[model samples]
Target chain A: MKILCNKADLLKGVSTVSKAVPSKTTMPILECILIDATSAVIKLTANDMDLGIQTEIKGTIVEKGMIAIDAKIFSEIVRKLPDSEISIETNDNLQTTITCEKAKFDLAGKSADEFSFLPKIEKDVSINISEFTLKEVIRQTLFSIADNETNKLMTGELFEFSGSTLRVVSLDGHRISIRKIELKEDVESKKLVVPGKTLSDITKIVSGEIDKDVVLSYTNNHIVFEFDNTTVVSRLIEGDYFKIDQMLSNDYETKVKINKREFLNSIDRATLFVKEGDKKPIILDIGEEAIELKIKSQIGSMDESINIEKEGKDLMIGFNPKFLIDALRVIDEDEVTLYLMNAKAPCFIKDEKENYIYLILPVNFNVGA
Target chain B: MKILCNKADLLKGVSTVSKAVPSKTTMPILECILIDATSAVIKLTANDMDLGIQTEIKGTIVEKGMIAIDAKIFSEIVRKLPDSEISIETNDNLQTTITCEKAKFDLAGKSADEFSFLPKIEKDVSINISEFTLKEVIRQTLFSIADNETNKLMTGELFEFSGSTLRVVSLDGHRISIRKIELKEDVESKKLVVPGKTLSDITKIVSGEIDKDVVLSYTNNHIVFEFDNTTVVSRLIEGDYFKIDQMLSNDYETKVKINKREFLNSIDRATLFVKEGDKKPIILDIGEEAIELKIKSQIGSMDESINIEKEGKDLMIGFNPKFLIDALRVIDEDEVTLYLMNAKAPCFIKDEKENYIYLILPVNFNVGA
Candidate 1:
């Protein structure tokens, strides 16, 4: 398509759409990004059957035409080119010449008819949330989703929307992360299971600052997110998600409060000596004034202590050191509170000042009274 | 060994020796660094049978002893500990405790006697060169060494140490880089083949000012480099290396000088569309004033041209753009001189004023003239 656009804006638009470009496609056309010049806007679209991204940028339309070019090659050349004005010239011979300053890339183009259509958003249920908040919730919870295909439904993060709150739950049957954020606009309660990879890719393009309210919509088979000048559509998983609330605990027999940094460092040291196989548990010996962490592996062992502001009956419990380290790193407050329900069962971990809770599925370890 | 060492010094020593420690070892003790404590100095050594590194640091020997610990674990713990005095205490049972600040790591230790002896210098002939110049020569030539283990001898850099100069040569049978520097201290003629990995690791740990001199010594089985408080010894490749000089042309038929940046960038752009197959050949069509670069791939194609000042007849050569890029990147001069003897012969690339010569074997292109 014949159009004039700022190299920076073109690069951003191409980068967002290129994420959906097929890395390895059976069909050749799936790797091409279709560029169309309509009025004063240049629209770029890329699709890989299941996921698609389309973005538009303001540009001067010289000749209203369209062409599909290799998404990866075009994006890479655009990124390396100077930031001056980029003039794209497309001809009926199916060739696009991108010229910038002293650099020019004449890339053979595909016919516009070869480009596939993006998934159409049939029913759009709009919701408003700050881009930063959405990204924060996704970052904390999406990574915990099951990547193995054996658990097909677990490959996606389960999103539960009700009233004014948006809750995201992801678990690989081992570790679980649940994050909830209050939305600005209310929508009909709906549960959508979106693939982890697609959501993570979309988050990359969305800036932390919410330039505009993100409009979310769900069709019969796909979920679409429209924000700024870009739109991303991802397929949804169809399955009955587990009742996550039932896994939460209410009572604890013993509690300990310690500085998050101090506890994390102590647990990190203990993990060094925690070996693989049968007897690799890290013993947490709790006293009136401090907690001692020790782990003995086949090669040797490690022991570190952190001061704790507590007064209780001396107790000792064994656990996987990595679990405590992970929970400590995610705690939002300076001081982390660990609620040990006899240390034999799953322990509830959270910040002393925040509502966040991280439940560790504890391994069976000997606890000496 | 029980010793109190400066955390910084101990960390540096461990880190340096660990570079020679291969992660996967058929012989188990190769993964451990032998720590020897003496009255005035503490030495750490790690060897993988082929190469070894030893660094002696001054420390207070509480009790003179020797023991070996897992290099990876020791390095990890030492790296994370705060900058302070770290006491490495080994008991009668061989259990080692590394304590720094509030963090402690107790690792299983083995007798230091299990480790292999360090390679010794056998030849008296040596050359003393400035660390800066030696480092420069190594950096410029090491990348050309063949990485494949098909021929063990070609995997190392070939060195020629004569009365007043030190020359380094490396080739992958396709591309060869040669760098020569005048030695500061007079020495007898000596030749040694040092493994590329040893020279590369030495470059990473190299310190001191440009005026500092490093001693190089060689023997039948090993080449040892002693600098500052560290000594690096690599097993020399047995047998003779391929004669790289014979592969380079003594004179040029067609020579042209071009700006290093301009030529490098042009070739980089041409690489985008260059596909290696039974199809189109990447063409460098040189005219009277500029060079037009073109590549045609099955997916698409790319064409770019840059202007240059030339006084010779027009020439068109088809060579792999990657080899040209590699040669161009090593040139320290602002302008690069490209010499072509013929289409079938190798191309010699060098700076307009430097003795460093890069030889790139030309690939046969079907679009052959």
Candidate 2:
């Protein structure tokens, strides 16, 4: 096989797919990226068994063949090559030669037949979603996914689609984050549990454009996302998600609208007293016109107050400051409404249109204190 | 002790001294920073027995006393405090209270007497040099210091002062780097070995300014550098440095002049084929008008020719590209001169003024191949 490619184009193509290459694996082929030049366009593919990425490089093709080379070495060589046309050729012995300007590299490559290929979807059912909306929804809910490998179900996010609305839910026992977006067209209803790792990679590939849309398709056990000149296929986790609707309640005894920036700053200041291993709780004491945040630790104690617009009866609650800060930072609203039933019940921070909801369980604290 | 200081001033003072705090030590006092509020100025000091740093913070002192607090915690707290006047008060029990705007912290502290103080230096010899010159000389030679703990002598740089000239030399078995500067005034001759770690910290504290000067004083076993509002004291290593002068020679069989950027870029490109455990050698064939760099490894081979103006006999030598790149990157000259004896001898890269010199030993390569 022989191909001529621009230095910048080839480097970008390799970097886009190299993110899916496994750093360490028992199988040597898993550490390589497959280069296929059987058609008019060249394609670079990388797969780590559970996830796969494929991107195209615009170049001139002289012949047609396929081979797999080490992802790391190939990318490094392409990045350092002079900004000129690069010629690549592979022999029957799987020896690949890359030459650009006065630099040339002859790398040992493995046969392409031993590498795993991404499973193709049936494409019977599909949906179109704007790239901006999909990226925003994933960013809002991805942080709550459980990092602990012991719980397989919690490591994935639940994606439920009905009519023209798509809802994404993620929970890690301590808190739950939910984001909902309306698609451009109505489609068949479907639900899938996608691993957090796949969604994280997807966010990197999709450009935030209002007019561009991604074509999403799913089969029995695999899902695919196609946008621009790239395609991503990931295996879906097999398990039943939690019944998050039953755990959520609309009933509350008190509600207040507070400035998001002011609330975040108060919690950040109170968290300074918390040590590394200390699970100190920040208590919010709500009054008629102001809310006070207090933290007590072995090393020190801190207190801060911010004025808020309150309704109904005043209430007090104890929570992990990090959980609140994480949810508030992703929220793009100036003023947020918080609902609380009592100090022992979970509190909810949601938007007026109900597009996003964050529910945090309160820590147990002595009421007298 | 009671003092009212600006938040920015306190943060800067604490951060500057915190660099000397030992990350892990058996003695707890080594992990703390001493805070002394005496007379009209407030001072922060941190000493790890080997090195110490002290900086002043302007503040209003209501009471006079001293205490010690954890360096990491104190710096972090000061960084997060509100942008206003911060008031600090210490009780007889050593418990310190810090208040800024609407935030307050009560932290446990120990008596300042438990911490080690900076040793007083007897100024038998002193020198004045611009901060920029000192910083440049250190930066040019520090990279050659041996990181291996077994070689105590090679881990320090020799500072030899004689006849109004100061020369700094460092060698790590493979290569030697030397930087020299002439002082404005002639002074007493002195020689000392400073640890690489101490020079590293000094570089961080001193700003690169031509007008600002650092007063350097040396005693029997210690060196003190005083500049700006900060003072750093370091213990001298008790050993003799290598005889680098004997290894350097003014004789050469071949001499070449080439553009620094072109030579550096070629070496960088050749080094890409070298893996972590693989010590690939970059061979340079010096002719009358052009120089060719070639590398052969298990993965591939690369060869490139760069134009150069040469003198004397034609020669070929091999070297570890990293050492050459390190010295070339620090050179401020547009074109550099390279002197070579043979393939098995050391090569020198120096400037016209003879202020800086780099000697690199070549790796033996097969002559017939």
Candidate 3:
């Protein structure tokens, strides 16, 4: 294949597909990126057995051909080349030469036919969402997913789409996070399970203001994201997701609006005395005007209080401080409201700026009646 | 011990000494920070046997006494308290009570007498040097020290202060870095081996303009640094330091000047190929007016040439690319100049910003050849 590409355009095109290239795989072709040059454009593709990525960029193509060169070496060389036009060509002997300025690299490449053919995204059921909203939703709900292999269903985030709203839910049995975003584009309803790494990579690439729109489409077993002239396709994790709606609270015994920063700091301090006993639980003693958090361990005990205008009858509840604090951090507002049912029920936390909610399971206090 | 201190002041004092506190030591006293309150100051001291740190903050003294509390617990509590005046008092039963606004922490304390005190520096012969200069010199030279404990002397940076110049030298046989600073302070000359961590911590805390000063004091077997209300004392590694002067170059057979950014980027790209070859060394073919960098492995081969104006004959040298890249990073100049004698001999790199030199010893590339 013969083609000419600008340094910036070439590097960006290669990097998009390089993430799917296997750094250590038994099959040599999995570590290479297949480059196909047509009359109008050039496509770069890389894939492991489970996931694949393909991106095409405009190039001055002199001849139409294909080859698979080592992704890591080619990417590194292209990334560090001086900002100028680069020329790449493949000889009939299966040797590829990449030349930029006065530097040149000749690498042995495999036949393009040896590469795994990636699945084509032929469906237009794609939906558009603001990049900022999608990234925030992932960050708010992703960390709570289980990281163990024993529970296959718990290792992925559950996504449900219905009535122009995309709902994302993640739970590890200890804590649950739910986020909702209104779809801006017309589309059919769908449901899918996204692996933990897919959510992490999505957040990594999507940040800042939502200047760019996000396009998402899914097949029977894979989901594809097309944004910023790059395409990333990942295999959907298949399992029976939990019905988290059953865990939501239906009654609220007490609710308080307090400064988010103050509550987080107080809970962090109270967590110090919890020494992971048979069951580590921090007790919150609520009064008319203030809430005191208390915990005792072998090393010491602590009592810290924050002021809030409590309205209901004074209540006491026991909770795992870490779970409570984790939920608190997802809120990016000056003031956050907490809805509690009782000492043994799940607690709900939410912020005004976001359409997200966090539910924390309480620990059994067993306080003498 | 009883004292009243600003929340910020107490937190800063505790963090400085707390860095040396042992996370898990067999001796319980070693895991605690000794807190002593006198007429108008509260001193915090912590040690992990190998290194000791002491810092004092001015506060209102309510009672005169001494006690040791768990370092991490106390620091965490103080860091979370409101930005108000914090008062700490000890009860008759030796329970230290910390109060800040509405928060309270009760922690068990051990007697300070059980802690082992480190040797103090003689107060007479302290030398004052520019804090910024000392910090810069340490940053340039300390990167060459070996991290593994296989070599006793190589694990520490040798500090030699004589006449008006303070010289820091470190080497791991494969590479050597030397930095010098001429100070106006007049004091007795001394040579001491300070642990690598001490230099790292000092650099972390000392940063300003080029004229601010820092003091250093030394005893028979320890070095003490006193600056910005923080005192770090470190045990010395006992041995006769190698003579670094004999390693400096008096004349060069050839000299080459190149743009610092260009050379750095080129070497960084070449490092990828070298790193792929079982961590093998890359060869530099230096000739009339250019240098060729070549790396070959079982997978493939890479060859790149960089143009350089030269005055000597052609030669070849083999060395690890990582060593050269590290030495190049510490340089803060637009242009870098290198002096070479032979391919087998050591090469010296000099930057135009300051009176510093780096010597990297080339590997014996052809031992089996």
Best by the TM-score measure: 2
Better of 1 and 3 by DockQ: 3
lDDT of 1: 0.79
Model 2, range B93-163, lDDT digits (tens) per residue?
Answer: 98888888777778899888898989987777679999999999999999999999898888889999999
How high is the lDDT of residue A287 in model 2? 94
Model 1 segments more than 4 A misplaced: A82-85, A100-108, A122-125, A185-189, A210-213, A217-221, A274-279, A311-315, A352-354, A366-369, B122-126, B208-211, B240-250, B275-281
Over the stretch A1-369, how does candidate 1's per-residue lDDT look in tens digits?
688888889998998898998788888799988898854678999989889999998788888988888888898788777678999998879878998776667768899887788866776567777777777777777656777999888999888899887888887776667777778767789888898888898789888686556678887688888888888888888888878889877777678888888788777766656555554778888888888887776666677788887634566777777666765665567887777776567777765432456777666654431
Per-prediction share of native contacts kept: 0.60, 0.63, 0.81
For each candidate, what TM-score against the reference?
0.91, 0.95, 0.90
lDDT for model 3 comes to: 0.81
lDDT of 1 at A236: 88
Q: Across residues A1-369, which tens digit of lDDT does each residue of candidate 2 receive? A: 899999999998898898789888898898899989998899999999899999998998899988899998899888888899999999888889998876677888999999898777788977888888889999999999999988898999999999988999999999999998988888788889999999998998788698998889998798889898999999998888899999899999889899998888778877777777778889999999988888888767777777899988888889999999999999999999999999989999998788999999999766454
* Residue pairs with backbone atoms closer than 3 Å in model 3 (clashes): none
Model 2 spans with C-alpha error above 4 angstroms: A366-369, B366-369
Q: Which stretches of candidate 3 lie over 4 Å from their true place?
A: A22-25, A185-189, A207-211, A273-279, A350-355, B22-24, B185-189, B249-251, B276-279, B350-354, B366-369
Q: Is candidate 1 or candidate 3 better by TM-score?
A: 1
Local accuracy by lDDT, each model = 0.79, 0.89, 0.81
| CAPRI-style quality class for the chain A–B interface of candidate 3 | medium
Tell me the TM-score for chain B of model 1: 0.94
lDDT of 1 by residue, B1-369 (tens): 689988889988998899889978787789898898854688999988788899998788999999988898888788777688999999888889899877778777988778786866676755677788878888888888889999887788888877677778988878888887777666777678888888888888777459887788877888888888888888898887776656665576677777888788767776766555543456777777877777766656566777777656677777877878877887778887778777777878776444688888777665622
